[model samples]
Target: MAHQSKRTTLGEIGEHAAIRVIREECPSRNNGDDAAVLNQPAPNTRPVVATDMLVEDRHFRFDWSTPEQVGIKAISQNFADIEAMGARPTAALLALSAPKDTDVEVLRGIARGIQQALEPFSAQLIGGDITGGEKMVLAVTALGQLGGNRKELRLDAARPGQKVVANGRIGWSAAGLALLRKFEEIPEDLRPLVEHHCAPRIETNRGVIARATGATAMTDNSDGLIQDLRLIAERSGVGIDLKSHAIFPDELLCRAGKLTGIDPWEFVLSGGEDHTFLATTSKETPTGFRDIGRVNKNTGLVTVDGLPPRHEAGWVSF
Candidate 1:
């Protein structure tokens, strides 16, 4: 008997094809212009740019997340980097690669998801590329423009006695993952918090607010709180003491003690991917910013309850 070859289309080629087609069709920004012709017409003032790569299995599980969700996450994470630097994102470029046998609509949905995430920020997608690969990988680059002379809140300026503040929620992702793993079903009431774990909102205004408030140092909580704070401590040449009691419950799991069977404090302390900003400033912190710690003169040490930050270690690429 003769064998029949399966039919295929652009979708079968995965995200790579889409990226290649877009790159070929779009103008190149290889000249170092802050604003790509596709992304912005005027020269952006701040002209900040950041890139993040999402690899399959490492960053996300295909079964656990939808294509749209993955796409949105890719965009949101890149934007969080921009916001962390105290800039406003104005445009983005997506580069994708995947297996040849994948569905085409999934790639389309990814693009739609990027558009969806961009819509809320009033940003635009300029251009990108697609290439063939054995796995699914998304590389997103986000560009931001500073409005005027607004300097970025670098991580090197933390000062002694400066209060540390957080702008958004935490531990929701860890809590949500626990629900998905231990409990086969997600409670209807818990859906919102789980969704937050999947996609928690980033504080767009707080970055500027922190900068305006004279923040000495700042960074986003992409990794767990302890680990990220350690970064600030090392960079600023200072020691930090986290007053754990001050952390607020921003996720449903924070309040889901009896039913969720999870320790909310552990998640709040160690849970990552929250994308919230943690900053230090001598002046009064902003209104929504909750003070969680304070900086000291000692260099490169972070502590909780008088001990080195031993709570939950932050994310490690390794």
Candidate 2:
């Protein structure tokens, strides 16, 4: 089942059976072997592949996010990368490394989360591996397909005079994280933001829309918006000027900012992990996307309304 599992802790499960339990308990389709066999892409299609890793304490915390939520976020983030390149995910492999003292129930929860994340998309969980380590770590490799001669939304394809468009929530995860760090009893109205921080729901079809709508470049806003756009700016050798009024915080983010004594613009401008779709289009903005900025001639610069933003440059891994 992708939702429930037997509740046995890691200490009770013992060391030798950890991998075996993971293989047996984790959900899959045509899996549970030394390796996985995947179907080739359909005719007139190109394959897309992406990987993302989640480290305990570095990327997530059990006290803040449930085991199931961590599992969901791990897979969802990887899927966001696949879609960012304008591809449809077809299969996934999850490799996990956790400590010997870890709970088997946590492993089951992660597996269930992975399966649940795949439910909305066409991808299948082909296989994975489990092993002992210093802490919990999850590495996911997702394989995708771009079909029908639609061009890939490469980051370097951006051009001057293109309109930058965005779809989905901006700064929600950051706002949620702020709440989790500061408040013990989160307000009911703001709890959803916190939940989003734990397990985000991405619109998997947005990348396809960008490809079909003549988008030249695209990326997911995993880092802060400006930081992520800078990738396109660097590769395409164009500047991207974001409109503050266009991407500025909504009422909830404003409320969170007021309560936290931080600028709401910081959340909108530099907050990371929202996985919102960002694209540069020469044609009219897609139906689901809103025009947020314009591509300009300034080389490799991302500005907010013609000036550098005041927030930090998104999430830094080092």
Measured by TM-score, the strongest candidate is: 2
What C-alpha RMSD separates each model from the true structure? 5.1, 3.4
How would you encode candidate 2's per-residue C-alpha lDDT over 1-318 as one tens digit per residue? 679766676666765566565555455656766788776557898888899999999889998999889988988899889888888877788888888777777887787787788878966778777777898899999888888876799999999999999988999899999988898888999888888889988887888888888998999899888889998999999999999899878999999999888898888888899898999999989878999999999999999889888885689898
What clash count goes with each model? 7, 2
lDDT against the true structure, each candidate: 0.74, 0.86
Which candidate has the top score in lDDT?
A: 2
lDDT of 2: 0.86
Rate residue 219 of model 2 by lDDT: 93
Backbone collision tally, model 1:
7
Give residue 205's error in model 2 in angstroms.
1.2
Model 1: per-residue Cα lDDT over 185-293, one tens digit each:
7888877666766556665667767777777678878888878888888988999988756764554765554466766776777878878788898899876798888
Instruction: lDDT for model 1, please.
Output: 0.74
State how far residue 251 of model 1 sits from its true place (Å).
Answer: 7.7
